[model samples]
Target: MLYHLAKNLIMILFYPLFRIKVTGKHHIPKEGPVIICTNHTSNLDPPVVGITASRTIYFMAKEELFEGKFFGRLLRKVHAFPVKRGLADRNALRSGLKFLKDGETLGLFPEGTRSKDGKPGQALPGVGFFALRSQAEVVPCVIISDYKLFRRTKVVYGKPMDVESFRKNKASAKEMSEGIMEEIRNLYEIHKN
Candidate 1:
């Protein structure tokens, strides 16, 4: 309920206020378990994609955010789970797989955290792991440029890529992960206006 309410309210409130323009809406799949991977820019990037997408995006949030009583509940309601950064957060990983197995879409930055300079960062191997484990098609996404007033937000939606194919082709785990990140980087290049 919180996800839906916050999603609708924030989009109505901040979209016009921020003048946030979204493109490539048709690229998002309407059903099934899909992974939405993008480069993390600002703190707003998560919700920006979450509300804009037509599905409830189950995502991993920093563990500290869920420590707060009031805020924790709110985050949980919105399909956000806390994952320990820099260490294995097994619980968080389990939740992600569960959501996907349940036929829900999951959102991941692949870059791991918000970029300090708002530039694309190196993506983590966990993204590749999940894609391989879940066998879900990855929807490569990019948020171009900054969020300053009148700054254009060009989102490029690339065709879904096959993680299994990469794995089957004898690509090492790191190689496959880098391959996924490279795909996102290429899309970023196109949408970076």
Candidate 2:
């Protein structure tokens, strides 16, 4: 499959180029529906997390990436789906939920967009909506680096947080988003060097 092939090749290629150091990989559950929430830094963040994680991840990419014919098809081949930005895109939300319901791994960037300064930012409420609605375990991951070529970059995966408690407590979407971001910040502070 294209996804697997790309991942294998990237695994080999990115190592020398980025010196991709990974930690806390065991924190990712081997099976079942799970969400991997990470900070958005560079355009390469998706693939970086994909190859490093033990499971195949279907990501929620921005809609414009799928505008071109060839590129759109290629993105699909790699298991990336388009999501309209700057508003609540229902179609995109359904796609994400369906993926989770089918017991697939879903990768998300809580910040919703890449950070120009490579620092974590506040998350949109979408991630929290998905977490609470699907009752999926949310893993807080942090990618530490300036993403400079041929430099060391660290991807740290933190333990999965059960969102079921939040769901039971009737937490708001914004609150859930804040909690997830806080988890990501904690992981970043601990591993950032």
Candidate 3:
């Protein structure tokens, strides 16, 4: 409820300022557990994706954002969970899996951090790990533009990637992560032109 209300308010406020354009929304799966992988370029990436997506997205936010008690509670209310960066956080992983098992959409920024130059960075292995373990389809999203105010920001959602193939082939975690990142990069390129 709060998430939708916040997203609606954001859309009303930011849409005019940013002129955000979301394309390929139909690519998002209508049902079932799914993972959304997007290239993060700015702090605004989360809101942009969350608001543009048709489904509720539970983001794996950095633990630092949850440091304060009040703010942390607010974040949780909006469906954002804390994730410790730089290492494998089993708790975060479990939370993500639980969300998927419950047939909810999970949003992930595979790079783990925002890109400084607005380009897709190397993805963390966690995304691939979750995709394989949960057997959830991965949707690649590309956000175009530098997110400057008054400029058009375009978000393109690509078709879902099958993680089951990688699992069947017994692909390594690194391989799965690279494959998913490649798809995200391709999606970015496809929309960049």
For all predictions, the C-alpha RMSD in Å is: 1.6, 0.9, 0.9
Model 2 over residues 1-193: C-alpha lDDT tens digits?
9999999999999988999999999999998899999999998899999999999999998899999999999999999999999989999999999999999999999999888877789989999999988957799999998878899999999999968778888999889998999999998888877
Local distance difference test values of all predictions, in order: 0.80, 0.92, 0.89
Residue 128 in candidate 1, Cα distance off native in Å: 0.8
Q: What is the C-alpha lDDT profile of model 1 across 1-193, one tens digit per residue?
A: 7778889998886676557766666777788789988888888888888867777898899999999899999888998889999876788888998988988988998878878876678878778767877857688887775777655566666777877778688776567667778988888777676
Runs of candidate 1 exceeding 4 Å displacement: none
Greater TM-score among 1 and 3 belongs to 3
Error of 3 at 72 (Å): 0.1
Segments of candidate 2 deviating more than 4 angstroms: none
Ranking by TM-score: 2, 3, 1
Candidate scoring better on lDDT of 1 and 3: 3
Candidate 1's displacement at residue 140, Å, is: 0.8
lDDT of 1 at 101: 90
